[model samples]
Target: MAEGILRPLGSSDLRLSPLGLGCWQFSKGRGLVGKFWPVLEDSVIRDIVRTSWEGGINWFDTAEAYGGGQSEEMLADALSALGEAGRGAHVATKWWPIMRTAGNIGKTIDERLRRLKGWPIDLYQVHQPYSFSSAASEMHAMAKLVQQGRIKHVGVSNFTADKMAEADKALREHGLRLVSNQVKYSLLDRRIERNGIMEAAKELGVAIIAYSPLEQGILSGKFHSNPELVKQISGPRKWSSGFKPEALNRTRPLIDRLNELADKYGASPSQVSLNWLIHAHGETVFAIPGASKPHHAQENVNAMRFTLSQEEIGELAELADRSKR
Candidate 1:
């Protein structure tokens, strides 16, 4: 497939690849919740980064909480090895807002920068909405960082519709706009669509950064064809109902539809799943699928190589809705 296409990121001046490389797996399951997967070799990490960059992925998403900050360091190292070419890549990292006040937002900026090896954070976000500080105060803090040139854009993850609006209002108080809201959205998880988050984002002209666009690989149809692959899964997903035999059997209709569409488009089921997200609500949605290997990275970028028709999209949406829990 050809290189990925770039689209405007909400109201920001910045542009991003429709599909971004998620770096959560780079933590190799080390920090807090990092043990979901086994640790990977340094060589393997570098190759994944290189493959993602060469595959036309301009943005990478990571977090300070991931692998206890190891993920950020690994991402920085991988990009640093690319030298000048990597300079153009956009890095998005998040601040863990647990048991901390808004002041911590300012205090931790330098540390995040340090972990990223001084690379400018293109999009800095609050990993969650559990900070001791008010949403307004946190937005102001991030706005201040933007004004001070510590970060380029301010975003949040896992925020509700009202909370997201509040954050945008607070940023506007500082003459800034909330550019994106990172959330778990896929064919399997349509809560964002039912909840007010998706509508709020569109109403406010904010981008929806979709994490787990592949539904933790459940939508990839891998486990269905090879049930043995279920044992190879790590972390919470190993025991999640989505991977159970009955759930897999229940979701067969959706998987079969995805496979049928993939064959028609000459793409993989994973690619079809992701493409549906990119065109789901015009260009307001973007996906960040994790890539632990070079082939995974390449396959992710290929998702952008094709487009699904409105009829195909509607059919898939129906199938997904039926398969939802």
Candidate 2:
């Protein structure tokens, strides 16, 4: 297991490897969001999962919105292929709340379980805060699932600080707690720090699962070195500000610092960035970097095999701070 220390996903009993595989790329090109990545063969997905498992990752994060449960199915199949299915590989998924009510938490759970091949949802989350009802209502529904043994933990994604507290309070009413909050956090986008999300998670004992910890490969420094590479990639990231010239120019210094640290540790820039993130807030922050290929999965697990000193972490943080100026 590479001596990778397992961290808690909040106060819950769930102990996860510092990094988990984000299954968005395994969506099978089935949904509006799934179109972001090309459909992969079953063998390819299995290989990625296999690499991650051998590298020490113990969990995965997928969503119902990702290919409308296709991601969940693919992930389960991959785990099963490796005999790592069942409770051995902890899996987390989110419920799509847009144009839906909290009632769907229970309403659609059967399909979710069926799609997952009955492997159990270790942590089931509400996908967003913009649902038809309040966060409290969503928590209540999630709590019911927990009580019914449908899910092991409750979490929320893309929620504001106040909204997270609201969900936590609702869970508390049932003698439960909101274990985690998944959000877009990375060296390139540290909005959670300025926006109170990280602080709130800490205060409430909620773990922050950082999705896009690589910032869609921006932190890899490849796109910055060769803008032409952007044309070959699919998805909205090519159109996002991070890939634009101005943003690239602004983030170059941070990327350079990542490379420097990478050389010192014999790691890739993505590894250094992922290392800094999981250690960014002690064990409070865990990251889910996606992988479309086996080597990408290998690089992600290699990220956990090393540690960044407080000085290097501080250096990267300072550079990121300056670049944002």
lDDT of each: 0.90, 0.91
Candidate 2: minimum summed lDDT over ten consecutive residues — where?
A: 80-89
Q: Which stretches of candidate 2 lie over 4 Å from their true place?
A: 1-3, 84-87
Error of 2 at 293 (Å): 0.4
Write one digit per residue (lDDT tens) for candidate 2, span 185-260: 9997899999999999999999999998888899999998899998887777777777888888999999998998
* Cα distance off (Å), candidate 1, residue 293: 1.1
> How does candidate 2 score on lDDT?
0.91
| Tens-place lDDT digits, model 1, residues 126-208 | 99999899889999999999999999999999999999999999999988999999999999988999899999999999999
Model 1, residue 162: distance off in Å is 0.3
- How does model 2 score by TM-score? 0.97
